[model samples]
Target: MSSAGEAPSELTGAFIEIAKVTDLGATGESETVVGNTTADVSISKDQTNSETNKHSQRRSVRTKTYNTLDIEVPALLVPGASQLETMGVVDSDGEEIYGDVWDACRIHIYDKEPATASSPAQTFEFENVEWDWSEISLPEDYGEISFTGWVHGAWRRGKTATS
Candidate 1:
C-alpha cells in the first residue's frame, strides 16, 4: 500500500536465483541448489480459447494452454550438464534422464536485494519442465558459450517476504 503523495513501487530485474532439483530422497522431498552462469530470464503464461455459436448466441470458453520459462546462461561442464540432463537432454554416455511430472524446481526472482524489507520477491515452483533447446551456440563476439532452453511446465508464483 502507498500513500496518495507517494510513488508506487516498481519492480526491477535483479537478485534472481535459479535452481534445479537434483535429488529426491526416500521421503519424496527434493533438494535444490542455485544454478551458475545464468542471465536473461523470461517466463510466460499462455491461454487458448474456443467458441461455439448457436442461434446467434455465442458461448466462449478459455483455458490455460501453455506455461513456459526460458533462460540464457553460459554453458558449464559439470552442473549445467547435469541440469540439462535432468530436463531430458542427452548425456555423454548416450543416456537420457527424465523427471516425473510431479517433479519440480524453484526459481526466485526478487524486486530488490533479498532480505530487504521494503520489496518482495516472486518465487516460481515449476513442475515437469520439458526442454525445448538441446544444442549450444558460440557467437563470434562473445567469449561465453551460451545455451538457452524453453521449458514447458506448470508453475505456481507467490510473493516472498512480503511487507
Candidate 2:
C-alpha cells in the first residue's frame, strides 16, 4: 500500500533472455510475443498443506518464492531455424539428423540496466533451467506457442557486477 496519498509505483524496463545453452548463447532477429494469461499461478500451490491451510492465514509457504518469471521472452533462435540449429546439430541444409535434448539451459533476468562499469544493475540469473513450448489447443481457440520455464537453484536477487 502507498503511504497516505502517495501514488502506487510501477516497475518497468525489465527484460528476459531465453537460450538453448547454459551460457545463453544465440543470434538472430529477436522473437517477439504477446502474452495473455486469463489466470494462473507462478509456483506450486498445494492447498492440503497443514501449515498454509491451517497456520498461515490461507497463504502457502511452498509458493513464497517463484523460480519462474512470466515476462515476454522477446525472441527465440530466429525464425525458420530448427531445434537442431539451437542444439548445434544442423546439417549441410541446416537440418537435424536426429532430435536433441538439452542438458542445461540458462535464463538471465535484468530488472534494471544491464551490467556496466559504473552502476550495479538489478538482475536475476537462473543457472540451470528446463523449458518447453506449450501445446496449442485448436478450433475454438487461437493457436499459440507458449514458453514455460522451470528454474532450479537459490533465489538470487542482487545487483549485477560490471562485466
Candidate 3:
C-alpha cells in the first residue's frame, strides 16, 4: 500500500492579493472599504456636473461563518495573522469610545513589514476591509471575514528534487 500522504495540488491555498496601507481619516469620522464583490452599494451625485458616482458599496465577498467552537481553534484568526493587534476607538482623553455596528463594519490594521529572525524584511500594508455575511451560513452564527490571516506553516517547503 502507498504511504498515507496525499499529493499536493496547486489549487489549495490562501494568498494575499490586495495589500496597501492607509489612514482611517481623522478619529470619529468614518471611512468606506470597497472590495471586488458587489451585493449592496451607496450612490453619490455631482449635481453641478450631472454625473452619478458610487459612494460606498459592498462588493463581492467570500464570507465564512464561525461560532464558539471555531474561536477555540486558536490558530484561526481574522485577517489570518497572529501579529495583528486590536485597537479600539478612544476619546480625546484617551478614553475608550464604544461604537455599534448597525450594519456590517469596516476592518483596519496597521502596516508592518513581514519579518523573520534573520531573513530580509519586506514592506506591506494591512487590509482595510468592509463586508457583510447575513447570507452565507447561519444568521447568528456568522463571524468576521477572515482577511489574510490563515497562513499555513509548511508553505516554505517544497517537494524534494531527484535526478
Candidate 4:
C-alpha cells in the first residue's frame, strides 16, 4: 500500500526534484518532491510606474517571474495514484485532470542529501507549472510550489542526477 506519491527513496532534508517537458534538462528521470520546502527566485520588473496613481487601481508592478514552490510534505500529497501523479497527479494516460494543466517543468532542488556526486543546490526550468493540489488532506495536512513567470526567454538548468 505504498503511496503518497510513492516516495521511491532519495529524499532526505529540504527537497525538490521534478521533471516533465520530456525530462527538461536531464538527470535521473526526475520525480521527488518533499516538503517543508521553500525556494523562491525573482526578477520581475518592466515598469508599472504607479498603477495609474492608485487609490484603488492596484497594479503596482511585476511583469512576471514567479516560482512559489511552497508547501508541507510529511503527509505528502492527497495520497494514492503514484503520489498523485508525482504531484501533478492523473496524466500519462490516467485521465482526471482539470484546470491549470500548465505542466512543463524541470526542477532539481536540494538543500541536503547530496555528496557522492553532488550538484543540486539549485537548478531551474519552468513553464506553466501547476503543482497545485490546493487541498490534499487536511484532517491532517500537506502540499505546493510553483513559480515560472516574468519571462526572460524562460530559465533552464538541470543536471543533478547523482549517484
Listed in order, each prediction's TM-score against the native is: 0.50, 0.34, 0.17, 0.24
lDDT (10s digit) by residue, model 1, range 46-146:
33555555666566555545433544444423344544444444455635433223245555656655457353356555555544334544233323344
Q: Write down the worst ten-residue block by lDDT for model 3.
A: 67-76
* lDDT (tens digit, per residue) of candidate 3 on 1-163: 0132321221111211122123422333333332211111121111122333355645543333321100001111233112122212223454433421112122122122223123212212112222222222211222233221221111112211222
* 1 or 4, greater by lDDT: 1
Q: 7-44, model 2: which lDDT tens digit per residue?
A: 11211234433344332323321222222222221322
Candidate achieving the largest TM-score: 1
Rank the candidate models, highest TM-score first.
1, 2, 4, 3
- By TM-score, the better pick of 1 and 3 is 1
Ranking by lDDT: 1, 4, 2, 3
Alpha carbon lDDT at 157, candidate 4: 48
Model 4, span 64-135: residue lDDT tens: 343233222333223345544544545566554442333345556677644432656755555445443444
Where model 2 places Cα greater than 4 Å from the true spot, the runs are: 1-15, 19-48, 51-84, 87-120, 136-145, 158-163
Worst 10 residues of 4 by lDDT: 1-10
After superposing candidate 3, which stretches have Cα over 4 Å from the reference?
1-23, 27-76, 79-130, 138-163
Global Cα lDDT for candidate 3? 0.22
**Model 2 reaches what TM-score against the true structure?**
0.34
Query: What's the lDDT for all of these models?
Result: 0.44, 0.33, 0.22, 0.40
